[model samples]
Target: MSATSTVRRFRTLAVPLAVLTVVFLVISLPPYLGLDPAKARLPVPEDVPWFYPALVAHIGFGSIALLTAALQVWPWLRRTHPAVHRWSGRIYLGLGVIPGGVAVLAVAPFGQTGGPTGQVANTMLALLWLATAVAGYRAARARRFGEHREWMVRNVALTFSIVANRPWSMLCIAVFAPEVMGTGPVDPAVLAQAAGVSMWLSWVVNLLVAEYWLHRTRTRRGVRGGPTAKHRQPVPATS
Candidate 1:
């Protein structure tokens, strides 16, 4: 096979991998969605005034954005049905990002575990999510498609923090399992600090990975034709 064919085959995997990730998140969510404090994975208590409503908004709209982004990233869909892509992008910005990010921003402050660290980390996540989403829309409206795609990439990475945050926190717990399990109950302060560290790490790691990916792709495009190739067309998988 030629080198071009190899690259083509490799690039084809991006959408499928993204689709699988979204599917995994969808399947993983039912356990976290209910009102029962026992069933809720978020540390926010059921008795808390903000928990249920905020949880519903975050889960409901975030799930929409997550699923929509998976489809939006498929090169075939955007290539063949550009209108669908445009409409869905609007949906992604409207019902998906607005309510979803705002819901988390409003609630994360009151509910975060880490005394200061967790609160700050989550607050940043919420702000970055909303800001990137807004920037993506503004870029699209301005017809700066490349900038729009990059902004959307950042937005999606932050949004995926929901999925990434859980596993990260669990890994942190696993690392300290001996100490935590030995104690009758882990101190709330300790739990808070752990959660804060995990939250920061999860979103930061995602953004780093995304920036590296965007940079690598642009480099590849530049190598092909001195940086004009990516500018000539919007990237389908970027959304």
Candidate 2:
């Protein structure tokens, strides 16, 4: 076997792991968000006019996108069922994410969760998410398959941020809480700091990963095509 064989094995592991990741997020994340009007957690006040509705819309469609995107990136589906791939992609970018992102953007100005730092991070995510989705959709329409795939990879990464952002926050509280404040529950301030770091880390890390994967894919395609390499079909989905 070649040195790169292990990379291939790891690549093959991507889809199943992604599916599991989304399932975990869809199940685990909502309770923490305090979607119920009566049981909101910290970083949110007891009551606000537009908060819960926005949270519901954001989480609702975002969850749909998260799960649907996993299937959209499934290698088998992409290869054997291009129509399914295409339609699922539409549902993901159109119904699930764009609206969800817009809803979050709507809520961001209200300074819901994450406060100023989080607000900034979220707003940035919303804009980038929308831009990448639009870029992907437009690329598809123009028949620029390569560009479409790249942008879709980016949009999917941002979508995964819903899962990614939470861990940094929990980890921060876990490590820093006991050490900094000792005993009892940690300060909300520490949580705020964690939230700040997580907001940036979540999507940023995903995008960096996406860039790395795209580079590896482009390189492989070039090698497969050899010196006269030109037209290349999209590779198995690892986004």
Candidate 3:
């Protein structure tokens, strides 16, 4: 490839790879790695018995989404055997539904953020994520390839929130830690709400960036006739 082409490819790969790497490390790491025992923490409320199960389900499904997302982007897996891609896609879709649906249920009664604004934001995010995933699956089933691809991209963007949440949380704490420490520490309740909002916001930003990138790629390829070109030379024009 030309220098320009190489640079373009590098630019295309770098950000997503960095984001994915950070996300994978954060999620895959032991849960206790960054814990501060002195900080205000939200323990699962014993009064609400279902909290533990919901949290477990959320994390489990989030992990499945992350794993399958990484697999979906593998060139060998995606291009070499599309059958495997399709199978994996279906599994990912199925696995996502339960947690995505339950997220809506859990967000409202979220003990950490009980107020109206928090409830509304959490509910909206959950519903939006779930709806996008469902729309992607439906579009795929209907053989609307372009729509399917777009919706799936959006779904994956939402899925990335699972990864983005941690980094955002860390940043929030870092910036506010001194104030928090001085003023009786950050309330776990407020932190949790902020984290949730930040997580969804990260995904939304990623989705917009991905959409722009995909558009630019498609436009460039169209102009160059890169992938869809049949041949360089043309035979005599058909009547």
> Tens digit of lDDT per residue, candidate 2, span 1-239?
68786555446534775677767776666664766666544344445677668767787788778878876666666777899899888888778889999998877756645567778888999999999999989988876777887888889899888787768767755675654455675666766666776787888999999999888888987788652112445456786
lDDT of 3 at 94: 75
Single out the weakest 10-residue window by summed lDDT for candidate 1.
226-235
Runs of candidate 1 with Cα error greater than 4 angstroms are 1-28, 31-38, 45-48, 181-185, 229-239
Winner on lDDT between 1 and 2 is: 1
- Clashes per model (N, Cα, C within 3 A): 1, 0, 0
TM-score of 3: 0.68
Residue 93 accuracy (lDDT) in model 3: 71
Task: Sort by lDDT, best first.
Answer: 1, 2, 3
- Provide the clash count, candidate 2: 0
Error of 2 at 234 (Å): 14
Candidate 3 lDDT tens digits, 17-109: 457755675646445234422221334666766665565566556666666775555545565688988988877777854474575467345
**RMSD list, candidates in order:** 5.4, 6.3, 6.9
Which of the predicted structures, 1 or 3, would earn the higher TM-score when compared with the native? Answer: 1
> Model-by-model lDDT, in order?
0.78, 0.76, 0.62
> After superposing candidate 2, which stretches have Cα over 4 Å from the reference?
1-18, 29-35, 41-43, 46-48, 179-185, 225-239
TM-score for each candidate, following the candidate numbering: 0.81, 0.79, 0.68
- Assess candidate 2 and give its TM-score to the true structure: 0.79
